[model samples]
Target: MVRIVFVALANLLILVRYLLGLPFRLLASRHRPTHVRFRLAGDPPYRERRRAPLRLRLGGSSLEPATVSSLESFQEALGLLAKDPRVKGILLELEGLEIGSAKKDALVKLLTDFRAAGKRVVAWAVSTDSVGYQVMCAADEVLLAPAGRLELVGYAAEATALGEGLARVGIQAHFVRRGAYKTAPELFTHSHVSDIQRQTLEAFLDERYAELVEAISRGRKRSPEEVRALIDAGPYSAQRAVSAGLVDAMCSEADLPARLEPPRPEEKAKAPAESEAEAEAEESLEPMDTWLAALPWAPVKWRPVRRKPRLGLVVLSGMIVPGKGSGGPVGPTTAGADALVKAVRAAGRDKRAKALVLYINSPGGSALASELILEAVQRVARKKPVIAYVDQVCASGGYMAALGAKEIWTAPHAIIGSIGVFAGKFEASGLLERLGVRRTIIARGENAGIFSVSRGFTPHERESLEAEVEETYQAFLGHVAKARGRTKEEIHERAEGRVYSGTRAMTAGLVDRLGGFEDACRHALNLAKVPTEKFELMTYGGGARRRSLLQLLLSMSSTHLYALCPTCWGLAGFKAGEHFDG
Candidate 1:
């Protein structure tokens, strides 16, 4: 009886709010803007942008009066412009855009589609790096501020080693890794790069450089050789870029409106009455936020309903770890095993979901967590087809989780493979001794003190730890072999913690196809035998919700036997924990 009354009161409040806002909503709808301007700046949550408002939103509160400018919102605004007859074109203000190469490619393709629909896209940027410039290149006309610069320097990878620095502070790192190319431990155990590590880094840089050259070549209508030469000669000033045909022209932000709307050939002799309205409409572009705010009824807009089959998209990003992961927009992100397992199981039980796409963007982490996620993925695969889509860096345990999927798709330049394991801890006995701090130990088992930072591992303990890591390594190889329908020996040939680019991984049988997220979704639908027209893609467990500082600290404190790729993590601009103050 109480619950019923609460529900009734909630509905009453919603009705009252709707009634009060109806008049304003109607007025705003009548005065809808003629053109939309989208600002593509900063890194947001979503990977792709839509051109218009969604006919249907998949999740989240409908009544919450809040708006966050994300990739999806930008896409929706562009989509609206594409469909609205009144909307003549879109202005893409691309400034300081920080996104991965795969996302850049996706955005470029989106612009291409928009242009194909007879809409013009004018991109304006102040200052941007090579990655941002690549996305800007997709627009019909690229504009830059007079003083802005393009940092088009070629790609380079840097790795930091702390062995010598740790030794100076009377500390040492004792670690064991299974593969020669597994250079993650070197950051602690070696002072400099190993032959294998140097080789691996060089190979990665070469692949990424080649990808950048190709993208710029296609965008600028230049040969690959020419693109490489131009990049080598960069960073370019705005005027220099225009002179070299890298950018179309130099224009200030205030002058963009005049540039966008030159005297139209057919409108030169328009009636005086028409010119006034046209001039007013073209005076300023309306932001998507203002347009959305005007239409409070937009959320409840009516649409035809259909009982279509759904594709479940589960995104596993950041460092894969045990337990519910921590952090969000305020700190480092983690992919918790418990959250992912529950999400995958939920998708498996959902009757409407006919297929699943496990979108992976991680460098891997805890071995146990990876195993748990892979187990859940395999369970879902039995009931519905599951495909893995590698977005950027999927290595070590990240690849381990991917093995559970029936097939894997990867971006051409995505970092894949790294089939290996490593485990160890910092030994601070010397540091303690140097500081004249004495400690006593008490233990109940032979290996009870194996993980104690106060002392190094005993010979017996070291032997035991190595055996355990070796067993895990063998199991990893076995899983990969079983998933690919190959023998352990054949898989072992490529299982030395060595990473591969997406194209090379396909040739190595590590992944089934070279494609992006959309391709993976389509393949999932095809495998499930669901019609594309009658299918809807539903996402699961990709939230980056903030956690308390205490929770974040706790999450980072716990240690595990890792299947992580430190090299990849470092290259991605993450810093691993180190002893002593910086």
Candidate 2:
């Protein structure tokens, strides 16, 4: 009882800590009016807007307690700047903008728009690596902290095969794939990649690498040879990057504001030491916000939320399955056909939905489920514009679903395109014989027991399964060729069940645009022809909601959820362990 009491108290303390630290607005805003104001103050989107020519800090990650930054929040922030009339130029302050290439692509598009309006977009990095450097390259003037370093190593991918581990476990993975280059099974069946797999991987890498080089060349305003040379001698100090023409200037982050602004008639550049000391003195006087001051212990209000409509976002972010979908919040997610199709059809039917963006992040599963999802998405496309955004690892069935979209947008480093199908059965007769266990099965149908683990497939059964796999593969090829407006030869040349990087996939005609979430959102919005930018985005419940301990405790009693899985219960009762071969 005493131990339990202590545990409860600890939980209470943790809940208190989190609630106190929440980002809810605690203080009332000052009611005042100022003339000739640019509303680009460093404030959250929820805060009331003011003047124009916004200044937003982009390099830092989202506020803590939020582990990763959501692309939605970033988009909304950038979208506000893109739409607001008071905002002309945006000064993007970069601290450590560690985001994937998909998010980066979105930033590039937003930044490009900012420039197209004749507004200056300046990027200044305090500390950065290649990912941060990429964003800086998009800015009109790339500024780096004096002590910071910039690393620009090219792309790389590595995979491991676990055939030996399975062999040691006395498990046989018998797989039959249609394509010669279908290498998914090889990860479990081969100790090393096959020669054909190596060739395909090399081709993927070459295409992506060339694209990377070209992007860097264009961003840095350097020749391909110059960018390639820089990549070879990567990880340069700020001074080295400036000397190599990879970045525009090298200055301490403290002096960045003046750098962002033009020199007044009497203004002159000062030394780093004078600037740093002055910056420190000025920063010390800045008052701490009331929320941060009381963060150690404070009460928070959970207010009701208001919803408005903008674009429809349907996310399919897990393995495809063929029943009631098992995903969202906590998950070993299974993207079910029934649930996914419903989401698609709902988006299509919604009159308020100006456009639909299908965000895919799956490696693919269940051919039947994938096909159903594809058909549903095609229906939505017929009504309104649909854009597919492959965040990462869209392969096989995932790729099939993506093709249903009018245009495919992917991050440069995002993985896409795996056109192959296979079937497999585990044979455990050897293990059974070693364990001195006798099992027998009797079936009337010819192929009823084809999947029985007590025996391997007969030659006739093997031929039949192979033929079925081949038919699926051919169907995949035909659909891809037709949708992409490419010949079978052209599609098959890149198929071979191989995954390609986003840029490489675009080159192979497997994907349309090399961009990120922002790009896809904008594309769908543009296709819908949204007259004004003051629109709200609504996201479907295809993701997990991070709940605070307090919220969980408060809702725990009200929440009623239970799973009645009879097969799992029976298996557990039998003490099957890893020895359940049937």
Q: What's the number of clashes in each of the models?
A: 9, 9
**Model 2: how far residue 131 lies from native, Å:** 2.8
* lDDT per residue as tens, model 2, 1-582: 666667667667777767655543333222111101111112222212221113554696545431123444444445444543434444555554544455556666667776776666667666665555666677788877788777667655454465677677666666777666566667657877578656655665575457567767878888988878888887688898889888788877456545554445433367768766745543311112321232333333322132234677777866676665543455245567787887788778778878988888776767777888899999899999999987566887888888899998887767777687877666667777888888887888777777677777878778777887777778888879988999878888888676677777888888888765655677788898874344556555344223333432222111111111111111111110111110
User: What lDDT would each prediction earn against the true structure?
Assistant: 0.77, 0.62
User: Which 10-residue window in model 1 sums to the lowest lDDT?
Assistant: 573-582
Lowest summed lDDT window (length 10), candidate 2: 31-40
- Model 2: colliding residue pairs: 38-51, 38-52, 39-51, 39-52, 40-54, 52-86, 53-87, 59-95, 329-544
Each candidate: RMSD: 6.7, 14.1
lDDT for position 165 in model 1: 92
- Residue-wise lDDT of candidate 1 within 292-378, one digit each (tens)? 656646554322234457888788887787888765566446788998998888888888889998988888888999999999999
- Let me know the TM-score candidate 1 reaches against the reference structure: 0.81
